[model samples]
Target: MPDMRVVLARELGYCSGIRRAIDAAETALRSEGTVAATDTLLHNAGEMNRLGSIGLRSVELLSDEELGAATVLLPAHGSTLSEHLGRIASARAVWDLTCPIVNRAHDAVSRFADAGVPIVVVGDKEHRETRYLMEAAGSQLLRVVTSEQDLDTLEISVSRVGVVYQTTQSREFRQLVLAWFRRRGIEVAEEMTLCPEVLRRQDGAVALARRCTAMLVLGDSSSANTRRLVAVAVSACPRTYLIGDAAVLPEVGLNCVDIVGVVSGTSCPQTTIDEVVAGLRQVCPDVRVEVDAWPESVL
Candidate 1:
């Protein structure tokens, strides 16, 4: 086996929004003994399981009885159901944990819709954030563009369109959508809604991946930001793997690589990143590990 070195990205793990949500969940769990969310609070499974063990519950939709009796926590990703705002008003208690950034995106879309501008949302149509944006735009929402194919099939009757992004989308994708609008001589009122912490992690992952022989992206498979990190890393280093936990490290053939890079999604826990580092050390006993220093402010 080759001598190995592991480099950990500086901006790995939980963003402020996710931290705020998790903290709120724990607080609610302690005070009320049970708290419910309309959906999984965040994209990470491990964190959800940890919270679940302590009385955090997720429901597809809260019933009137559940709403009347339980403390309901709005998800960090925000919600599409505007009617829920009315229902939540009558709940026992409500915690609106929507990220400030997401709220800003919502405000931007609402302003565009109020101004009678046709809106184009550039993100996964099925994503909760995208759905929220669409709901904010209402009938002014033209369509959602997830790929170049979506843009190719797009038929815009208007000369000017307002653009909004899912908070976790990549800058590259944003640029692609903007460039498409530019080429067509369409005026764009672009709202910069991408989460800064997510972009920082992506930047860190790509930088490390460019120099390493293999890259490991740590986060739940269902996490959109985590999947984006994997995609960006794979573009820089072909031997990139997305693992939910440390147990998958041995199967990833890190022993063959001289240099390995590790990065995690914003929703990932710090403990998971530590476990991955420990797992790397176990795989290559003489491995040298280096971790970058994180910034003081991420917002």
Candidate 2:
């Protein structure tokens, strides 16, 4: 087998918002007797398991039975005011961990709706963040499109529109939608709503993919950012694979390739990244791993 080289994406692992959410969850677990999260607080099952050991529980919805906890924590993805108003009204102590970027998205959607501009939300329809954005639109003329193809189904006969996307969506997808609208002679308000850190990670994935024969992204399947990373990597390298953690490394057959790229989403913990790197070293002992320098602040 040829000597192997592993190129690490520059922007991998947790971003500032995810770091804050994790810290807040850990803090809640320490002080509260029981804490229930609106959703799996940030998508990393290992981290959730660790928090669960300390009395953190995640509920799909905030019904009466789920609201008996001492504290209810909101996921960093944020939720719609209309959809979550009842829960917010009933919670005894609520720790809203919604990221500021997502809050801005809600504001942007509200503003566009208020202006009577047709709003298009570009993201996965099932994603929590996208669902919240849709709910925020209220009775406004709104459409949700995961790709450019979805736009064709929209009966938008208007000349002007506004665009907002799930915080973790790629800029490439957003631009594709914008370009499509512009081609049809429609004026786009263009609220460039994607998260900067998420875009940075996607760019990092593309850069690494260009030089590697294979790429492995570490993150949970449920995470929007994780799915974006896989999509970005697959565009540049067909051998890209998305794994939840280091344990899946050998099974993914990284040993069969000579050059590999490694990346993770903002929801991924640094410990997971370390384990993935170690797993790569162990499985391919002769390989040279060149990890890019990342800021220590996120760790």
Candidate 3:
């Protein structure tokens, strides 16, 4: 018998933020009877497809056709909240699925701006969460990249910089950016509010990958956390695959690997993980499967 060992990452799966967002969307879909949103509730294609089969659909932004009726769900990735306020004013109902973790970040910046601190949101400019935070904070926001190029070009002299981050970005990235601003001797009141769910899941992915030669990172392609997990696995182990489901598995191999690991993002469901694991086991019956400790530490 080929000695096969499968390392199952304990932390590989949906984060609490995605769970809460999906639950809120489902509940809103049931209660409101019809719903639409600015974009997909989560980055996962599988979950969006599942939602499509039910009733949660997205509409073109602020069109007259989608106006006057129906509930709209703002994705957990917070966008400019004020942009929503006016549009939602016309809707019969609004189901705010903004993750509490994100909402806490929003509050931090909003309160800081209200207190007259000049705010600098450190993250990708195009991300939905950054956009939302800017809108919520109104006039007190400017986006900052890793270097000072963007900040140097700015015409304003900010007395105090209030920093906020995207909930799903790497915690290491968040810390680096925060430290960069403070190093300049500028007054900074920074809120380190990146979602714990992200760091927890990321650490879990790293831990799980340690025991396996190969890993399958289960998650949507666009999911920040899922991508991070796949990256972590590749770094820890030699070979890693990022797949939405078992169908995404490469046809050429899997039975060849003596040790394989499976992990997923916070947005992924248990069924998807089980299905992939089952398929891998079917291909290699002798493979030993064990839980990776990352998720256990998180819980």
Candidate 4:
């Protein structure tokens, strides 16, 4: 077997928002003996398992009985459910770990709703973040567009509409939605709510994927940002693979590849990235792994 070279994407591992939520969960668990979240803290299963091992309890919805005098941590994607918020208020302590970026999107939706303008959300309809925005928009939510087909099916009753997007939505998709609105002569009140860290990771993945023989995207499949990374990488490098961790490296058939690129989702932990690199080395004994420098903001 020939020696292989592995290059890592510049922006890999947990983004600022996920890191903050995890830190808050840990801090609450240490001080309060137990911490509970209304939903999974993040999309990564491995991180969720790690937190669960340390007194982090996840519930689909907060109940007054279960939350009695317990500390509650909100998910990073934010929630607009009044019932959930009301239940959380009764807790002994509440840590709102909603990412600042997500909060901004919520605010944008509220503003549009207040103005009686129909809101068009550009994102996955089933994603928690998109659901939050849709609920925030209430009766004012005009449509949720996940694809060009959705836009084609859209029937806008108003000449002007407000647009907000899921924080983890792809930039290209947002652009497509915006352009669709423009083609129909609809005035758009747009809020660019995509996460900066996610954008950086997507850009880095595309760059690395173009040059590598195969690409590996590391993160849970359920994560929207992680799945977007895989989609973007595949468009540039068709041989892209989405793996939860290094355990699946053997199944990926990387032995014949001379160059491989690695990129991770925002919720992924650095330890997972390290494990993938180590696994690559084991697969190709003479593999040379190179990691890009981390941005100071992430450091």
Clashing pairs in 4: none
Give the better candidate number (3 or 4) by TM-score: 4
Summarize candidate 2's per-residue lDDT along 1-299 as a digit string, tens digits.
65578878777778988889989988888884667887777888888888888888765444675575458888888765753676555666888888899989989998988887788888889888888788777777468898766876766877888888888888788778878887899888878788888888887788778878888888888787898889888989999998888888778776635688898988888888889878887887677778755432220
lDDT per residue, candidate 1, 17-62, as tens digits?
A: 9999999888889885447887789999899899889888764465
TM-score against truth, every candidate: 0.93, 0.90, 0.84, 0.93
RMSD of 2: 3.4
- lDDT for each of the candidates? 0.85, 0.80, 0.73, 0.86
- Mind sharing the TM-score for model 4? 0.93
lDDT of 2 at 107: 91
Rank ordering of all candidates by lDDT, starting from the highest = 4, 1, 2, 3
What is the Cα-based lDDT of residue 158 in candidate 2? Answer: 79
Reference-based lDDT, residue 203, model 1 = 78
- Regions of model 2 farther than 4 Å from truth: 1-3, 59-69, 293-299
Deviation from truth (RMSD, Å), model 3: 3.4
Local accuracy of candidate 4 as per-residue lDDT tens digits, 46-149: 99999989888865454567777688888898876784657677777777888999999899999999999999988898888898899989999889988889
lDDT of 2 at 283: 80
At residue 240, what lDDT does model 4 achieve? 96
Residue pairs in candidate 2 whose N, alpha carbon or C atoms collide under 3 angstroms: none
